[model samples]
Target chain A: MNALAARRRHPAAIAILLLLGLVAVGGAYSLLAPKQAQASVVSAGDINTGKSLFLANCATCHGMNAQGSAAGPTLVGVGAASVDFQVGTGRMPLAAPNVQAQRQDTSQFTQEQIANMAAWVASLAPGPAIPGAQYTSGQNADVAQGGEIFRINCAQCHNYAGSGGALSRGKYAPSLTGSSGKTIYEAMLTGPQSMPVFSDSNISAQNKNNIIAYLKTTQTEQQVGGMTLGNLGPVSEGMFIWIFGLGLMLGCAFWLGQKAA
Target chain B: MTDLDTTGQPSTDVVHLDEGHHIGTGGLPARFEDPGLPTHIHRMADDSPDAGRRAERQVVALFGLSMLATLVFIVAYFAIDKSVGIFLPGIGSTNALNVVLGVTMGISLFGIGAGAVHWAKTLMPDTEVVEERHPQASDAATRSAAVGIILGGGEQAQLGRRPMIKYALGGALGLFALPFVVQVAGSLGNPTKALAGLRSNLWDIAPGVSPIRLMRDPEMTPIKASDVTIGSVFHVMPETLKDSQHVLEDKGKAAVILMRLDPNQFSAAAGGQRAQAWGYQGIIAYSKICTHVGCPVGLYEQQTHHLLCPCHQSTYDATNNMEVIFGPAKRALPQLKITVDDAGYLVAPEGFHEPVGPSFWER
Candidate 1:
């Protein structure tokens, strides 16, 4: 090591080495810089457009300050992620309010309009924002590792395959099969509805990516059995076993008895 | 065997014979006729030598395949990585190791069954025999003979004559059951101690000790009062549980859910004044275990101030001192009384006054 330090005295070599180091740093910055930009982009939108849209469409129920009214719950602290989820999914500008907001066929607002509304609401109190573009990038995600993470963090409420299950009262863990990579990440970050927030402090960004990968993989590849029987698990499996297996056995016994007689 | 006559009635035509022995006069029938069985047909494998050889080879091949599949299963079990994915026709992608192991094991089991069925059908004996059915009831003389044989057996053994042997056998049989009885009795160890442990969990603190600190579960970090937000909920465990060997057992009893609500919304329901005073500010801690079947009650509706148990639809109103507002839970979730120490960290001043988790019949 001492001999190597004494040998490296060439000016040309030093310059070349410096250039290579600069290029490496530049390459890394280019690779990583877009993610930071994308996060800022999530929080950037026209505040005036957002306010005008809210007053015209939402203020009647949510109130002018968006602190909730008798008709609607407070949206003050609920943030951009909640707005993106509620409005992006077309569950917000509810047609005729009901027990629970249902997913609609098409979102009434455009993507730009949704972004503006999210920015306005987010500016009010500063809560959990929608997951940045890096979360949904889906690069270097290990599907198998994701399966393990999903089983631990999600399977209790959502079914083992992200098929969703009933929770307490009228609530249910919605299926992740239809959820986009962004939606699933945002839901984990923001904890929409009664779901508990799995913050970055709890589940890291990389772990969240793994979970999204697992969800996407499950959407394509589910149970490989001849028939799934609705994938309700034990209830369907037990019913099929009792009815089909017993019926076949009983038929065989009857046939054998007839032959004997 | 009685032969069926043309009139479909049984006729006695065969004579009974006992070689080198005289027949006892027990009033049994003297003669009966043999009832013929159906004729047997030879299979192709049995008739033809070449067919028989082919059948033998097929059975051998099946057994060989079975051995090969078993070897494959064993090799796959060790060599294949569980995470490796394989795309199968009609099945889509699945764990390669599981698929290989299942297929090989299934083939191994199926080969044995198929080989046995084929061997039985082609090579095994196919003979029909007719056995005569007699009256189910025995004659009075036969019954008496059976009783006499039993009596003869007793006399030969001389059990009645040997009092010592009789008593020894009786004692051995009686003592044989003691081990099982002792095991059952030992399993039900001092019910009072078990009940006391259930009633007073790890949070019960014990006498002359400082108040137990409330730590974040899994993280085991002490939580400050300022850390808790209005709508936020924390899954907490006692600091004493951090180094305990029985973490799961202790955590099951000691797990508490800490939630903060508006002070104006707090209502004194069942516990009244005492329950209201136990809370620190609007922040209160209640047993995480549901009163109905003891599921962890984690789901909280911040808007309604309802603590929901996932196992059952038991909703506890945290604002009303964690009263069971809905579902099958008849009793309220027990509240943990908490206070801040000089360090400004949350601590359990005293243990839960009432038993935590599902209620017993004695309660």
Candidate 2:
């Protein structure tokens, strides 16, 4: 006790104490931290194939080690979900460097190939994984609650109907009409392009499923009011009334005012 | 008729001609004669008895059709279910009840109108007639009498003789509007008091009290620092809002958008350092009300780090202390200085230094 009290005044004592404290915290955190669920299991062979494919296709923009270059951002910690959303949606391996990447109808890679790349990216660092089927499926979701959540969080950018809207500098929030349940989940998890992330911590898995269910219900629901005018809301409806409705009235007036033959 | 001179004055030289005289003899007609209406053309209903009978039958049929349509409308209104969906050829899906009600009502009205029109055009008189228009102004004697009556009424009131009463009445009538003006203006409230109210919001922590927790909007759940991840955005409100007298008004002023980004991503040239210092780690909070026109600036683009107001497209760089990068926003969004509490939940240690929302006169 006398030696310890004397050493406490030493110059290196504070540094030693801080280092010991950091080590203890790190060890405790590793043991106590919640485990990240692995949505899919990837083999050693899958990682090797993904590495080879990435080298041949992506090494030009991204460095051989997937480090960022002047042309592209680094994919070090951008998880498997990001890769799946980007590659699976055919938004990456970009056609050209524009304001934003456009989603293509068909992807360049198969599901297995995309999975392999996701595995390789996941191995690089701790990041979000592809969501499991239980969370991705919209079954047993509360559409009404999901609608409230969507309006608060998503309606500002994506529009009230999820029909997409324009952003600044040629960017846009894409429509969620035909997006698959898996794609929707991954997009929320990854936050591709201009979209902000809605991680599991921010929006729970069940809430996300509810949102998916609501979106799906919108696609299938009958438009009871007849013509939707492209579902672009009041602006389009107003313009239609101004043009067609007024034009028809004007035509009728002209016909009515004409002298009988 | 007299001819006008080039100077627009009536000339003394004038010539009048008889009714049958031609203008070739150098005489002007005294007046223009009115042209009579054209020869009447008779319709089949007017000339033939069978055609008249047929027209009468057609009118009766239209009236009968109107009665039938009214009956249909009443029956359909009671029979059709409100929830039943019907397919329209051009309009697609629609409510069966609405369509039926609208169509039946339209047909019933149309039948009556058409019946009345057909009865008038075919069976009733189709002859054209003219009626002369009378002069709009009153005669000089009548106008003079009206003016005299008004002047006599004014004299009877003693308005001219009683100077004191005249001026007093005038002043009373003129000043009578003051109360109304004052009431209306007072109802608008004091602008300075309103501006003072705007200066503080739900985030303002009272002295000697603990800092306010940042709760998730709508859900009102308390947020933890760990819950916010990189590129994730959260709609937040101060926990003090639970006790607010005017929840909507307080919420409008205190609503915030919280976002986390990579600390290194903040640009040094745009007040990014100060923004980072005010935040806890990379999680920063800013007033959601737009600096332009008080719109909710809710569109947060993660990669571009831009917060675009859906109204007016006022874009703010979220990483650069909410600096206006594009559109008409005049100033940066006010940042809320935040810190983590002992329980690791995000809390606002202090309210915004500047008034939030759009610029007002006092600001």
The candidate maximizing TM-score is 2
> What DockQ class does candidate 1 belong to?
incorrect
Backbone clash pairs for candidate 1 read: B14-B32
Index of the highest-DockQ prediction: 2
Please write out the lDDT profile of model 2 over residues B1-363, one tens digit for every residue: 234133444445444655565344234445645558888888889889998999999989998998998998899999998788887766666778888787778778877977877787787787888898999999999999999999999999988898899899889999999999999999999988887898988888778789999998777889999999889999998898898899989989999999998999987864999999999899999999998999999999888899999989998997789999899999999999999999999999988999999988758
What candidate 1 gets wrong by more than 4 Å, as runs, is: A1-43, A64-67, A103-111, A133-156, A159-162, A177-185, A188-191, A196-233, A239-261, B1-83, B88-92, B100-132, B136-153, B268-276
lDDT tens digits by residue: candidate 1, A135-173: 775567988877876764567677788877775556677
lDDT values for all models: 0.77, 0.86
lDDT of 2 by residue, A81-128 (tens): 888899878898889999999987767777777888888888899888
Chain A TM-score of each candidate structure, as shown: 0.71, 0.80
lDDT of 1: 0.77
lDDT of 1 by residue, B17-110 (tens): 7555554333334554564566677777868899888888888878888999999999999999877777767556667887788889988986
Total clashes for model 2: 0
The RMSD (Cα, Å) of candidate 1 is: 19.1
Residue A191 lDDT, candidate 1, scale 0-100: 65
